[model samples]
Target: MGQAMAGAYLDRGYAVTLWNRTASRADALVAHGAVLAPSAAAALEAGELVVLSLTDYAAVYAVLEPAAGALKGRTIVNLSSDTPEKTRAGAEWFAGHGAVQLTGGVTVSPAGVGQEESVILYSGPRAVFDRHRAALDVLAGVADHRGEDPGLAALLYQINMGIFWTAMLSYWQAIALAEANGLSATDILPFATDTSDSLAGFFTFYAGRIDAGDHTGDVDRLAMGAASVDHVLHTMADAGVDTTLPATVAALFERGMAAGYGADSFSRVMELIRAS
Candidate 1:
């Protein structure tokens, strides 16, 4: 994610300083006119606006701890895959140490960086964001302010990961089930790709219904959908395929059926999946 954002900043003519604990990682960026910060302190001293994209919360502190004095009055932009609590803690840590920090999420892959298709998100002082807006735009066309909470960006990021994960899982799971029926990867690739592409729109549209807590049978009714899923399970089992994913879905459907939602839409089963 850091590489993606950095590539964008470089593309947009923003002077970006690059660094990695593994120095070799910066070689490509350095070739692209990004000056390497020799050490953590040098990196902080090198730029007033610094961005840290590391592995986790612990790594954040490890990098900053060595450069505490160098960070005075600087701005820190962190775009790590961290939880919300970690984001809040890191933001507060930077504030206590005299840096104006911003928590951010990058929604684009490395290839999407510097293009309009990617989005970079921020959460912190709106005033600070306004001041830095021009520089941020170099990374993506859509750099958004989420809210006052520094954790909102990461929260959104994790939710997005769920969409990606389940989509990928659905594809692989379908392929696995088909392989049991003598379908090779090549045979299933086209259909899997096209079908998953079609289903991709469902997350967004269905998510609205899920969030609104509306189980109105807008598309397919629950009982009918459950019947279709039952077919999938039976096919998998008859072909000696493992039923882990379908089994979980069946569990949810069974719970929904018990709750008298068997006649409702498939999305009404969201209640069965909720923590409560």
Candidate 2:
């Protein structure tokens, strides 16, 4: 991702100074008119605005700590993934070194960087963000400034990832079930895609009701949903496919049923999840 971001900037005619633990990893960028900094400190000192695309906050400290002296007047944009708490702590750490930290959450893969559809969430001091907005826009089509809180970007990123992983896993489970029934994944592609696409409508319909704490079951009932899940579980079991995913889902629905939400909307299961 670091390489991609740097490449994006270099393509835009920005003077980029590249540095990595393995210096050879930046050979291509170096050939493209980007200066290859000899050390992390040199990279930090190269400009007032420093963009970091490390693995996590741990790696951020590992690289920056030894180069602390160069950070005093720099604004560090840390796009690494980590917990919100760690992000907040990192902001404080940067402040202690007389540097400003702008937290970022890149929503697209490296290949998507610099694309018009790509998004990057940011959070930090409003003034700092406004100052660098033009430069940041080079990295993504949507440089979404989430809020003044430095951790908001990380929080939203983690929440997005939570949905991403679970939704992808559900797709995988569907593919497995289809394969067990002698159907290729290609055969189920349209149906799976249609079902996945329909979720946005459901989410839109349920958001207001959920926010209002109204699980009236007018649209759907927990009892019916649970029964449907039961059929899915049994079908997978009969197909000789692993049932772990559906089993876990069925168990959750069963718990909701046992908790007397059987007559309510399945959305009421949110209560059970919250208590858990």
Candidate 3:
């Protein structure tokens, strides 16, 4: 991602300084007129706006802590992944070093960088973001400033990843089941895509009701949902495929039923999740 971001900037005619724990990683960029900084401090001193695409907060500290002396007067755009609390703490750490930290969450992969549809969520002082908005937009077409709180970007990123991984794993489970039934993933592609696409409508329809705490069964009852989930579990079991995913889902619906929400909308399961 760092390489991609730097490449985007270079393509836009911006001078880029490259640095990495492994110096060889910067070779390509260095060949493209980008200066190779000898150390983290040199890199920090090379640019006023320092974009970091590290593994996490710990890696950020590992790289920056020793180079703390050079951080003053720099704006650190941290695109590392970590918990919201850790992100906030990182902002404070940078502030203590006389540097400003702008937290960011890239919603797209390296290949998507610089694409118009690509998004990067940012959170920090709005003034600072505005000051560097153009340069940041070069890395991602949609530089979404989430809020003043430095943690908001990280929080939203984590939420997005949670949903992404869960949905992807569910799709994988379906693929496994299909294969067990002598079907190829290609055969199920259309149906799976349709099911996945339909989730947008479900989310839109349920958002208002969920926010209002209205779990009336007018749309779908927990009892019916539970039965449906059971069928999925049993089907996976009969196919001799892994039932872990469906089993966990069925358990959640069962909990909703046990909580006396059997007559309520299946969306009431949100309550059980929240309580957990």
Candidate 4:
């Protein structure tokens, strides 16, 4: 991702200074007119706007702390992946060194780096964001400032990632179920995609239900839902597949029944889970 970002600036006619833990990866960029830094400190010394694309927030901290003095009066844009707490912590660390800091979550891979479609989030001082907007745009080309929280970008990224992971897991399970019934995944994909889209629409409805604390079941009762869960667990167990997931769901339903919510909604499980 770092190399990709650096390539964007080079293409945009900005002088690029590149460095990495493994110097070999940067060899190609140096050949493309990017200046090679002998050390992390030297990397920041080369530019007023120092950008970091690291493994995580911790890695960013490790690299930047040793170059603290080198960052005096400089602006550091951290595009490393991390939790909101970590992003806030990282920003504070940089601020203590008298350096302006911005933390963001890059939402695209290497191929999207220089494209106008790529999205990068900025969360820090609006003034600092406005100052370096031009340089940042060279990489993302579509960066948005997410207020002064310095953590909203990371928080939003995690929420986005949650949607991805859950959907991916559900899709994999659907694929496995289809294959189990002697149907090819290719044959099921188009309709499965449409089904997933319909199911995803429930998130908004559920969000309203959650906010209103109204998990009343009208059509989808808990015990009625448990019938499907039982079928799933039995089928998975019978097919020698991993039964952990369906088993867990079955357990939740059993708990809900014991709580006398068998006639309530499936989402009522949240009440028990949140109970102290």
Candidate 5:
């Protein structure tokens, strides 16, 4: 990701200074007009706006700790993946060194960097963001500033990851079911794609009600969903496919039903979730 990001800057005629724990990892970017900094401090000193694209907060600290002195009066854009709480702590840590911290949650893979459709979620002081907006745009065409809170970007990213991983696992579950029934994944691909695409309408319809704290079952009831999930669980079981994911869904629906939300919309589970 670091290499891709640096390459993006270089492609746009920006002078990029590259550094990595394994210095050899940046050979390609170094060849393509990026200066190979000798150390993390050298890299920090090379640019006023430093971008940290490391593994996590731990790695970020390890790399930046030695360069804290050089960080004074600079801006640090941390694109590393970490929890919201850790991101908030990191912002405080940077502030102690007189450096401003900007949290960035990249929404695309390294290969997608610099693509027109790629997006990155950012959160920090609006003034600082505006100052570097043009340079940040070189990394992705769509850069959304979520809010002033440094953790907002990480929070949003985790929420997205939660949905994405579950939805992807559900697709895998469906594929396994198909394979067990003598239907190849190729045969079920179109249907799976259609089913995923159809959820957009459900989201749009429920967004207003969800925001209004209205989990009325006028559209769909938890009882109905529980029954449907039961059928899915059984179908997967009968097909000799793994039932772990479906069983987890079934448990949640059953819990909602038991919590007196049987006649309420499945969104009512949100309340139970919040209480927990």
Candidate 6:
């Protein structure tokens, strides 16, 4: 990701500096007219806006702790993945060093860096963001400034990632179920894609209902959803396939039903989740 970002900057005619724990890892960028910084401090000192695409907060802290002094009066854009609390703490850490910090979450893979279709979510002091907005746009065409709270970007990232991973898992489960019934994944591909594509409409419908706290059962009842989930579990079980995922879904739906939401919309499960 770092290499991708550096390449993007270089392409934009910016004087890019490269640094990595493994010196050889930066050879390509160095060959591409990016200066190879001798150390983290050298990299920090090389640019006023320091972009960090590290593994996590632990790595961020480990890399910057020794060069804390070099961060004074600089700006740190941390695109590391970690808990919101840790990201927020990192913002504070940079502040303590007299450096401005922006917590960022890139919504695309490294391959998508610098692409006009890609987005990068950011949260920090609005003034700091506005100051470097153009440069950040070099990394991704769409730079979404989420809020003043540094944790907001990370929060949004985690929420989307949670949905992404589980949705993929659900697709895999569907493929497995199809295979158990003598259908190849290729046979189900188009239908699976169509089903996933249809979710956008459901999201639009559910968002308004959820925000209004109106979990009306008129459209889709929790009881109906729970029963459907049970059927899914039974089907998986009867096929001699893994039932763990569907069983878990059924359990959650049952919990909502047991919570007196059987007559409410499936969205009523949020109430159970909140109470838990």
lDDT of each: 0.83, 0.95, 0.95, 0.85, 0.93, 0.93
Better of 1 and 5 by TM-score: 5
- TM-score for each model: 0.88, 0.97, 0.98, 0.88, 0.96, 0.96
Model 6's alpha-carbon lDDT is 0.93
TM-score of 2: 0.97
lDDT (Cα) of model 5: 0.93
- Candidate 6: residue 34 lDDT (0-100): 93
lDDT of 5 by residue, 160-230 (tens): 88989999999999989999999998999999999999999988988899899999888899999999999
Model 3 ranges off by over 4 Å: none
- Residue lDDT tens for model 4, 1-276: 999999888888889988899999988889989999999999989988988899897788788778788988889888898999988888888888888888778888899998988898888899999998888888876898989999998898887887777778767776777778788889899988898789768887788887888879885789988888899889877766666666887998889988999888899988877759
Clashing pairs in 5: none
**Candidates 4 and 5, the one with greater lDDT:** 5
- Per-candidate clashes come to 1, 0, 0, 0, 0, 0
**Per-residue lDDT over 236-265 for candidate 6, one digit per residue giving the tens place of the 0 to 100 score:** 999999988998899999899888999999
List, residue by residue over 194-270, the lDDT tens digit for candidate 2. 99899999999999999999999887999999999999999999999899999999999999999999989999999
RMSD list, candidates in order: 2.4, 1.1, 1.0, 2.4, 1.3, 1.3
lDDT of 1 at 233: 85
Residue pairs with backbone overlap in model 2: none
- CA lDDT of 136 in candidate 5? 93
Model 5, 46: alpha-carbon shift in Å? Answer: 0.5
Order by TM-score, highest first: 3, 2, 5, 6, 1, 4
